[model samples]
Target chain A: MTLLEDILLLGLIVTAVAAPLCKRLMATVIVYMSFGLLMAVLWVLLESPDLAVTEAAVGVGVTTILFFLTLRRIHELKGTKDE
Target chain B: MSKKESAWTRFAAWVNGEHEPAESRLFSMGMGPRKERRPEITLPKREEKQRLHGFLSWYPVASAVIGVILVGILLATVLAMPSFGQVENPTNNEVPAHYLQHTREETGASNAVAGMILNYRGFDTFGESCVLFLAVSCVFILLLRDENNTSQKDLEQAQRREQRRKRRQDVILQEAARLLSPFILLFGAYMLLGGHHSPGGGFSGGAVLGGALILYASAFGQDAIRRFFNEKVYNTVRVIGLMLYAVLFGYYIFTGANGLENHIPLDYGGLILPIDIAVGLVVACTMYGFYAMFTRGEL
Candidate 1:
């Protein structure tokens, strides 16, 4: 369990630093969403399932959608050939 | 003399105190009126321009470096803190002890957290609902569009975009949304109603409900959602949810503060359930309202 927590904490730090470093806006949003996922896991490990659920829903789910919508609106996601 | 030389001569004359400052006169002596007196902007030399462009290209990298350093500092600070759930931790105070010991009896909630938020500190939850309400209202003010605000060309462009999307409909997303929305909505309701006895509560459950709504909206388009969740219904739900919480919690505070027992047979569990539902409604509306206002600018 300690090992898993250590790995998760490391992942959290990596994602937190990598999000802003991503060149593409899409990659940045995805990295940030992953950071949220790791935080949710941390919350669960800390025995606060209430916070875990809220974090997953608000952080990973709604906020990511909102970010994608804003990106699309600003035309930052245009001309992608990635079918 | 050229314009620059004459302006310099006028400045030297003014410094000598030969006459009045000639502020208005000198300003009016430009090519035309004050508004049209444009200053000549010279571009930087080649080397300076190159340096500026290089700096511009490196700005993002510099900011990213600063961000990483800040994150490192924060991580170091967090790592140095006490571990979670330690008995000697500062958070292991009498306040939590009291809440854990007496929450079930006083609030009739199996979940101490739900009891804490919805019963003991219900006014705080009510304030959060008000914040959500005000947030959606602000978004509506900033983003909601109607015939007056939307232009004909914008409407045409939107229609064209919708048509293009309809032409290239993502069948997989639509199918998944159709298959999943019902279960998602059911789980959200369960979380909301069972909040007092479970780990879930209004915020999470309402967020899940909002996520389901957003998925359905994305797959089925605005017209389909507007059939049931029109602007009128949205406004009514948001306003009614906040008002209900305010009135009920206000009554509770008044009665409790006055040291008067309730005439009604409503128990703590009943009060918590209603407040949870009210909060759920406000949060669900806020999430969906933000999505709708951001995307379609109408709901």
Candidate 2:
């Protein structure tokens, strides 16, 4: 593979590792969203703008917000103070 | 010669000194230095034998029947060889461009799909909205059991208990949520109203709005939001909206006058009917209903 492809693969791997390790739920969500955004850019690079738009809006935007909301609800139920 | 032979024998004995006698040849061959002997294979006998026999006899009978049936089906399918080549693709005769042009001119909706759904096939949309309303009502009833008697103070105490157990910092999240929720609501409304000309539609737009409310509740508290948009009022809005949509659809079906037929007399270009307004209301109410059911922890 080219240097650029190798670099992107490395970045993706780092993000994947970091997302799970992040202690805060919101930070984890943001990391996951960044992964999605990067994936959308990859889709755009592959010449499918429609899929890119859908991934950006539905995958990153709406889904991330949903995750954040769910996390908040869980925290509220458990009555645990944020670190 | 006898002395020389005795000396050679003594030398051989010394070379093999302190070595233990090897076991039987068969045992030695099977159980070598680092190797385990093969386990003995014995035929089952007596009571143990009967159990094996019982399992073997019954299992084969059941397996044989299933195997035979599956084989028969496979053979029949192979022999019948149903042809898929004879299947015909259905075609619509209406020219898409012409239909689109006519719909745009008649309804003045920039989007053809919206025009078709809201104006031409409005009955179907009404039914769909009614179904949504019914689902929301069912969810609301299930969640808000003993609705009239449950005092606000009781709900507040419950919320406080849940909050304490969770140990969440409500103030900080609440502040952030207060800042962000308005923008989310605005975006959702934009998607709902601009749906006639854009990619966003009722379902997605309603979800966005519902998501915004859920965010608000999570950040601040359900009690504060509930005070503004009460369960009964939301339910009423949902019912009224569905009824309005049904009435408009029935009007078109009975009177032959189109309900959302955009008659642009003046500068407004396309005039929206009570139908679109009803749809927006239903969407908003049903979304809120879902949020209430979800946040209230009933399911």
Candidate 3:
């Protein structure tokens, strides 16, 4: 369990750093989402399943949709650039 | 007629990033005319531009060093703190013990965390619900489309987009949504209703429900969702959910504070179910409302 946690923690750090450094907004959002997912796993490891559930649902799910919508609305999505 | 330039208007202009005088002491002290331009000492423009370029070139390295230092400081702080989940830790107080021992009996919730949040520290949860409610209300105010706010060109553009979406709908998304939404909704209902006894709760469950709603909406378009959850129904559900939780929790607090024997029984987790449902309703609506408003500027 500790080993798995360590791996997840490392992944979290990587995703956190990569998110801001990503060139494309979509990639940044995706990396940020992976960070959320890793944090959810860490929450479960910490024995806070409630937090894990909320993190997965809110941090990963709703937040990603909102980000995508914002991207689309701003005409940042692919193929919308020409328009 | 020249507009009177008060501090408020000047501050607003500053916030909007409008061009301002390099030295505004005279204008700020209200002693000089606002429009007067004064020549002041300055660096040669070419030299200043070179200096700016030099600073800009070093900005990334400076920021990276600062980031590393900040991270090191935070890590050091965490390392200096005691290790996690120690028996003698400050968090292992009598308060947690008391909650653990009495939660099941007092709140009839098998889940101590749920009992604590929904019963003992209910006002915190109430405040959270209010925040979600307020968030959706703010989004509605900012994004809701109507004849007053939406221009004719915007309406036509939206119509064109809708038609385009209809013409090139993704069959796979619609089919997958049809296959998966029922199970997702069922799981959400289970989480909401079983919150008193399990790890799941109102917020998580409502978010799941909202996710399912968004998926269906994305697959099928606005017309299908509007058939059932039009503006009127959405408003009613959102408002009523918050009101229900507020009234019920307020009654509970009033009775408890006044030292009266509450009419509701805590044995069967009397208030937990209703409160959870109310919270779930608010959250689900808030999530869906955000998605709908963002996508179409209406619900």
Q: All models: lDDT?
A: 0.86, 0.66, 0.88
Model 2, position B166, has a per-residue lDDT of: 62
Per-model TM-score of chain A alone? 0.93, 0.76, 0.95
* Comparison by TM-score, 2 against 3, better one: 3
| Every model's TM-score on chain B | 0.77, 0.58, 0.84
Worst 10 residues of 3 chain B by lDDT: B257-266
lDDT of 1 by residue, B149-263 (tens): 8999888877887897899999999999999999999999999988988988889989999999999999999888999999899889888888888888888887772224554
Q: Give lDDT: candidate 2, residue B107.
A: 56
lDDT per residue as tens, model 3, B12-102: 7775557475587744656555776788879999999999999999999999999899999999999989888899988899989988997
Q: Predictions ranked by DockQ, top down?
A: 3, 1, 2
Model 2 compared with the native: what TM-score?
0.53
Fraction of real interface contacts that model 1 preserves: 0.87
Runs off by more than 4 Å, candidate 3: B1-34, B37-49, B257-260
Which pairs clash inside model 1?
Answer: none
- TM-score of model 2 (first chain only): 0.76
Report the C-alpha lDDT of model 2 over B1-299, residue by residue, as the tens digit: 99999777776664445232344353344644776778997756886789888999999899889978998999899877754334432333355556577766665566666677776777777777888788877776566645454788867866676677468556777787889889988877776666566544454565666667767766666666777766667767777877887776675566544533332331221433456657867866666666556545432
Cα lDDT of model 3 by residue, A9-78, tens digit: 9998899889988999999999999999999989998999999999999999999999999999888889
Between candidates 1 and 3, the one scoring higher on DockQ is 3
Instruction: For candidate 1, report its TM-score.
Output: 0.82
Question: Interface RMSD values for the candidates, listed in order?
Answer: 0.6, 4.4, 0.4
